[model samples]
Target chain A: MKKDVPYFDKVHRWGRIWTLLALVALFSVPLVFSLAHDAWPEPGPFLKGLVAILPLYWVSGIIETFTYTPMIGAGGTYLSFVTGNIANLKLPCAIAALEKADVKGTSDEGEVISTIAIASSAITTTVIIAAGVLLFSIPVQWLTKSPVFAPAFQQIFPAMFGALMASYLRKHWKTAAATVLIGCIVVFFSPSIGIGILIVVTIVAAVLTSFLFYKISTKKSAAK
Target chain B: MDFKSNWLMYLLAAGVIGFVVVESLFFLVKAWKRGKELGISKQTLVNTVTNSAIYSVAPAISILATVFVLANALGNVLPWIRLSVIGNLQYETVAATSILSELGGSLTEEVTDPAKFAAVAWGMTIGCCLPLILVPIFCKKIHKKVGDVVNKSSSASALADVVAAAAFIGIIAAFVSKSINGIEVTKTLTGENVVSSRAGFLSIATLIVSIVVYLLLDTLATKKHLVKFSNFVMPIAMFTGMGAAVLMTQLLPQSLVLWSWPWLPPVQ
Candidate 1:
């Protein structure tokens, strides 16, 4: 355990180093393209495009860091942010890994498991997308054009969420019930609400509900 | 150089993908070695790798669908690189379309000019790059703060878990809510009120089927005490639900099976 302490510290040191490196690499994609083509983005339209999605991404990115960091732990958080696909792929995979390993997210074991899961998923997704790109014309065309495949692809979100909800809702019924009710009303009425805003709203509702539930239960026990 | 599809563009995209692969593998190996040191069994580590990889396939394929969709407009290489990196189908499509439309162009038509293509690509890369930049800066501090709160009391830890669970529930609920949009009634051209969302109905049906499958398999896994089976229930349920969605589309009326709805905006 004493030795393991340095391991985590080392992870943080290395994680930050690797993340900074990856950041430079990612930014260089556009930079390289612009240099290679000798064509820079037009300022007016680029700013307009940036403005359109900037607020949403900025808000969501900040909110997600807060919301997901505790759930996935340190190493997982660093890898997942770089790898992307948090809500849909990485989070669920981490949770599943932790559950399978019988580890708590706050524990050292949990951090390691979550990181392994996320890293593996990231690799798988990247490799598959790369393959899809290489085979663009025939396989991709068939997958998109085939009538049998279209409906299955379209319902991916629902299928994913349904399984995820079933696993999670069993233990946190109170929180699940409250947030689901609120989420449903929001989605049904204001369908235009983006996923980022919806996530923030849900987090607030969950925290408040949990606090209220804790208070009520404590009061009941005190009365007893 | 053709702005649409060029060998140079493919090489550039490959470079980005190659970098991601190397980075991902680096962390994966580091984490795996650390897990072993932490006394996590080799079997547990193997299961994590296998299950996560298997679970990723369906979603990865769906992402491929997005790549194809965007390929028509932005060309294959750029969309491939974007989707493989931090960008999802929704964000990339929206960012590209927003920039293209603002520049007096449409996604349906390819951006022939190199400048316009660069603008859209740069817009997406910049807009979505926040998470990568922000996470490294704040993750350690955030984890320490949360860990402090959780360690303060047993009740606090419980509350924290509940909060996490609730967040997950809320996200799932939002997705499920959109799935039921087909049940909503709206006025039609013939003055006959009808359900306006065939696609929604399909989604809802798929959700229900998947949930049932997940629950049933989970029950069986628990009863049988099958540890491996437990790890796989979600992916199994998702595939089942997706198959059911395809079947539902065939059985249901064509008018009810929509490709897109007003409430659930298209990626474009």
Candidate 2:
């Protein structure tokens, strides 16, 4: 926030402070609940539960940070991860905004677009969800759970990625083909593949294939 | 009703959820102001906000539906807190279910023990906190290094774009393959493992239908020049695909698909 500080530097400074606050806020819910009700977790059950879930989610957390941080930019990464729904809502929405603007995601213009779009998505979702809980809980609950709507809820991922994948594949088939092929091979071996591992493997494959394709296309052009 | 639904529980959830709201607003304002200073038109920035909001409507509604399901065990406030923060339906459900099981509690049953309830909340909390912690420490460094590498040459810059697109393709590919292959990820030692899978022909049908409708919408927007209507294309295509799901469930029979898992019914 200092006048001499650059915008990018300022973002990191404030982002660290806010992120630390958010982390504390995240843990406070249960801590306060225990204090208010005089209810404490029995150490054995708590450790058992923690042991089962922590390693996998944490490893993916590590993977998600590395993979998505570069793509979404610093500001986008800070906001989107906190607001959650990175893959489904935040990442796709930011990429789509960048696509619409015809800017590269690595550009400064791309950072502004991604941050604005992700922040908007986060606020909009929070408002809608808050409204649902406070004002329209009954109708919202019934409507979403109704037979007519249940299938839609369960199948949201396929519904979302169908178009998104098509749009990306159309423009970047050279890289897309490589990644998708690798992803399928992995899936064939393990039908229910861990998303973090899948992303890591396919991304590595993509880098190699794209380099190969890039070299070939350039060589052909030079010869011509 | 259990202790999870008490008035104090709602207050605690609101406090945490409120923090997220404030965090979002703080970033939204900062970005909006930065966009203006960068000489990006106000109209363009406004369009981004509105268009992004329109895209969010479907996903938010679907998320609320998941909240209702989670509410059965942990009550309304806890699900609201978890979902509004860094957790999703699948992750939250699995975390809470396993934690309850450790305490000899059932997620399908109303939790009466305050200690067990507190444990579930703690479990969900610790599982998702890594992102928030890791981001603050590492995000600035990662962003800058990646940007610096990309700027080294025109070819490097171009490769950056391909790499980003490839990341998206990598994720979507896993999802598409899951639908085509019959794979259901129940929580396991690693938080996700495939215990059962059905012949997921029904999901394949939905995926195809969605792709077709989206293409049609793209045609309408680009070929027909429906500029104003373009904003609704993604959401419209999404809902239409949902309609396909309903139709497929009603008309498509389990017997019709080869290797179909007999238990993978249309709905829970």
Candidate 3:
């Protein structure tokens, strides 16, 4: 709490340091594993794999960073990107925490809440995965693959997004509904459309829908 | 060299996981302090943490399912480290398969050769390393620009909220649409790519069940003023919806829809 420096500035400074540390830590895993095993990669196949995948991976990476950083706030972005599971886990957790705290993403309070929420989610996921690896690898693997628990696990996306849609749509039906309709139409026709384009299309529609609703409400009030 | 579940590999995985856990704790405590400084109540922050943890449970289990699949060929330590850190199930499989295929091996086959195993590890790491390198460089500038737009006007702020809500709706629509259109090629967490038939009806049913349960919870918690019910809304809704999925599979005709995702095996 440096009284002189703005909170955002402090957060950025801390975020950058931690992010760099994370990078070092992550890169070292492969580096050290290769060293310890006395097994360096064969460059021919490695580069071939890299060539096949890096282009698309980098493109999605750039897109996600540009789109998701601001939405989740700074600290949350730093942690979520490192922890992985953005769309499925961190983003939703941060959004729910924001809604619960009743703070806008742009607010200072919102930044803290999003950070706390994301950090908590990351830690919990880490611990759970660690435990799964350590204790019950055999049982957990069998259980997840079991027919009875399989469907429940398979529907995680629906279970999550459905709850989110119900909450957001109930509040902003006009905007959310229009966006969902357009998204469904496009996605149904071509289910392979990347999420990047879907988000761009829906954002444009949602903003326009909101503007249209405001105009209609204003005209009605003026007439009255 | 046997690359499967060696002590050294387990130690390395634990080290990476441990480092990340500490990083998360650092952020958590720092942000918790920052919230106090910003005049938020301790109770609210605690509740947010609690709720976020609860919200993460189901998805975390699903992630573990992915780990299991990857571990089949690559061994436990590699998949554990990859998925725990930055390698998502999708990207990890794609990267691993790319390298394995390039090496004239398949994901179903284990890498008895340590050099090939190390190559696969490098493939997974480097493919997903872009954001790790790029975010720290560019995120601050992006965040500031967004804040400028958000703080520009009252109307702008309102639009920003719409933007966030739209993200949610858009993704849900994409997911549910996959189910509705009913001919999606989905990658199971088990690393199998298969064409799903009648999954649309099942997903749509689950989505609707989730929505209805959420509505019921909302009505009870908010309008009916059952304040205690508020905290459990998300977890409760998600679990019930999942339960409904299993039930729908049992009740629906097997010809039309069965509890047959991983059960249907692979059409690919």
Model 3, span A1-224: residue lDDT tens: 73798778877888889888878877787788788878888888779878998987888888888777877878898888889988778988887788777787778898999999999999999998989988988888887878878788888777887877777767777766677777677765666565555665665666677667767876898999
Candidate 3 residues lying further than 4 Å off, grouped into runs, are A1-3, A194-197, A218-224, B182-193, B196-198, B258-268
lDDT of 2 by residue, A56-115 (tens): 779888988888887786788888888899877998788777776667777777788898
Off by over 4 Å in 2: A1-3, A135-138, B187-199, B251-268
Clashing pairs in 3: B179-B200
Best lDDT among the predictions, by candidate number: 3
RMSD of each: 4.9, 3.2, 3.1
State the TM-score for model 1: 0.88
Write candidate 3's Cα lDDT for B102-217 as tens digits. 88777887778888888888888888888888888898898888788888998787767666566555555555554544344545534466664444567878888888898889
Worst 10 residues of 3 chain B by lDDT: B258-267
Candidates ranked by TM-score:
3, 2, 1
Candidate 3 backbone clash number: 1
Ranking by lDDT: 3, 2, 1
DockQ of each: 0.59, 0.64, 0.64
In model 3, what lDDT does residue B217 have? Answer: 91
Q: Model 1: per-residue lDDT, tens digit, B141-258? A: 8777877887889988887766665655666666666565523333222223344343355777788898899889999999999887887888899889999988888887876765
